[model samples]
Target: MKKLICSLLIALPLTTHASSTLRCDSGLISLQDSTSIVSSKCGEPISREFVGYREVQDEYGFYNEVAVEEWAYGPRNGMFQFLRFEGNRLIKIDSKRGR
Candidate 1:
């Protein structure tokens, strides 16, 4: 039981995780980066998609609808990167190996 617990603890950190930053030819794009910055650094994704609109609340408790978009870049080194944006800020980054 102790060995199993130790092994599980050791393996936990090795699990895949979503990245918050992407390295581009010009610079690194990170979460909360503006769309313009990502575009300038990454030089346009292979595809730009409008996922939908997300409702967000402000500090004042006013609700606003923001555009949600997903951009795909790759197959760089046999992997593809997907970027998700809410309004004009990058919110998430994901990567997957191509088949």
Candidate 2:
């Protein structure tokens, strides 16, 4: 039981960091920023995707519907990033590794 508890405590931080919100450009990109802001600041992405309606749970624990979108950016031969947007709000950013 003690070993299990210790292992869980050690793993907790990894899970927390895994789901942590992502930021870009020293805080230029944040969770609450709108898609328009991202476009103007980050310029046009290399690829864009419309994910359509998705059922989501809000901070208040209420289920709601939201429109999801994804944008990908890459600079020539550099790393590529994937940004997810929900209802015009930037929600998540994922970087492609081993690029």
Highest lDDT model number? 1
Best by TM-score: 1
Worst 10 residues of 1 by lDDT: 7-16
Which residue pairs does candidate 2 place in steric collision? none
**Ten-residue region with minimum lDDT total, candidate 2:** 11-20
| Pairs with steric clashes in candidate 1 | none
| Model 2 vs. true fold: TM | 0.62
Off by over 4 Å in 2: 1-27, 59-62
How far out, in Å, is residue 52 in model 1? 1.4
**Root-mean-square deviation of candidate 2:** 11.7
Cα lDDT of model 2 by residue, 1-99, tens digit: 345434333433322122234444434676768999888778777667777898988899999999999876653344455678998998887654322
The global C-alpha lDDT for each of the candidates, from Candidate 1 onward, is 0.81, 0.65
Error of 2 at 25 (Å): 8.2
